[model samples]
Target: MFEELRIPTLWITKVRGENTVEPTRLAPLMQYIVDKTDKDTAVIIEGIEYLILENGFETVFKFLTNLKDNLLAKMRC
Candidate 1:
């Protein structure tokens, strides 16, 4: 569906998952968004449930908190 909109997208997945071009490491994923996104950027993150399942709620919460902080700062610009 996203592809139909012609927007550039990145897909992350676990090491054993198929059809995934990128690894699902939290840091790298956040870094990629930080590097690519701006105040006007709209992002679609599709796999929070999967992330929590794989890495637990606490870890995912921290990751999301950091990512939110970063994006919020950017939005202030």
Candidate 2:
């Protein structure tokens, strides 16, 4: 899954089980998040706000830019 798609930082929902989401890593949009998972502390990443909370590097206005850049980079191959 990581080697297939092109979206970086594949959001993982640890509520249900391990690796519940697909496309683990876009492999193009700068796949980040080395140690996001916290067994002791869980963070729910959802809605538009979650994007900012989880990925503070992106701002509301800059979100589109980041999204486009990442997506484009992932599909470049």
Highest-lDDT candidate: 1
Give the per-residue lDDT digits (tens) of candidate 1, residues 8-76. 576766454433434347897888788778777887888788888877899889989999999998888
Give candidate 1 misplaced runs (Cα > 4 Å).
1-6, 15-24
Which of the numbered candidates is closest to the native, going by highest TM-score? 1
List the global CA lDDT of all models.
0.77, 0.41
Please give the TM-score that candidate 2 achieves against the real structure. Answer: 0.29
Q: Enumerate residue pairs that collide in model 2.
A: 7-26
